[model samples]
Target: MAIENRNICSLYDDEKENLLLLHSAELLENISQSKEKYRKIIQAGMAQWVKGLQEGRIKLDTVADLKLLIELDIQLQKDEEI
Candidate 1:
């Protein structure tokens, strides 16, 4: 028996990726509003972001969030060493 591998890159084109981009933009817009009133909405957006990454709804390739997370992790490690 032979096993086949399918790459996610081949699954989504520029159009589908644009929808994900739009969703992310909307989330950011919601985040920028008054947190006092939109607290739950902001938190829900963040929760969904994490959930999407874990569940493979969002792909990490060339993504800024992943890069920022890595940089923050490095900064935390450095702070811990001080």
Candidate 2:
């Protein structure tokens, strides 16, 4: 009976580890897809900003705001690295 209990516990532990690994893999995949989507969105926004700049629709203040946003992003990346 004791041997049977030990085997059951071991089986449960193995299943738990497998579940954790599966969950991690799925989470990583979702994050990767989200990052790609965000990248495309950012690119599209930048292109629009450039177009507005060339057509004299976007103002200098708007450019300054964009610079601030880039600086914030850089700061955030540095924070994450730390």
Candidate 3:
């Protein structure tokens, strides 16, 4: 005589559906929490932008984007006597 044993570890169809719903709720909650965090980050960034503008450290309209800023800074640094 021989004895065989097997173990199954799978969610049934209904259980899988319930898990999906729970996962979706968790994701939504995460996004909702992150929204406020993103808003604070944006606010801080805007303040920095305004300060840069006041100091004439950042010229926005003339330069298209960050690439120009980086290039110009590099050139200025290279022009130093050092």
Candidate 4:
């Protein structure tokens, strides 16, 4: 037997609105958690990068690369404001 998809339009307006609200809340929660996870990962990676630089394990020779990293960090900071 083939599974059939139900038409959302068949739902009453209030029911549709409730469903949409529930879905939106779930999506927002997922987005929030994902952002937090990525933020922690980025922070850890940055700490390791800095440690490597300090310990002479990594060498950055170009001003452009350093500038780019600085710009990216700045953008991440701005994102936190939202």
User: Which has the greatest lDDT?
Assistant: 4
Worst 10 residues of 4 by lDDT: 62-71
**lDDT (0-100) at residue 68 of candidate 3?**
47
Candidate 4 stretches with Cα past 4 Å from truth are 1-9, 62-82
Candidate 4's TM-score reads 0.67
* CA-lDDT, candidates in order: 0.62, 0.69, 0.62, 0.74
Instruction: Give the total clashing residue pairs for model 2.
Output: 0
Best by TM-score: 4
How many residue pairs in model 4 have overlapping backbones? Answer: 0
In angstroms, give how far residue 24 of model 3 lies from its true place: 0.9
Q: Over the stretch 15-77, how does candidate 1's per-residue lDDT look in tens digits?
A: 568878999989766654533344444455556667888999888773676555555545544
Which pairs of residues collide in candidate 1? none
Ranking by TM-score: 4, 2, 3, 1
- In candidate 1 the C-alpha lDDT for residue 50 amounts to 79
Cα-lDDT of candidate 1: 0.62
Alpha-carbon lDDT of model 4: 0.74
lDDT by residue (1-82, candidate 4, tens digit) is: 9966578977788989999999999987887687677667666667777887899887887445545555666676687677
Among all windows of 10 consecutive residues in model 3, the one with the lowest summed lDDT is 73-82
Which digits, one per residue and each the tens of the lDDT, describe model 3 over residues 6-34?
32236577777888899999987786566
Per residue, candidate 2 scores C-alpha lDDT tens digits across 55-78 of 999987788756754665455456
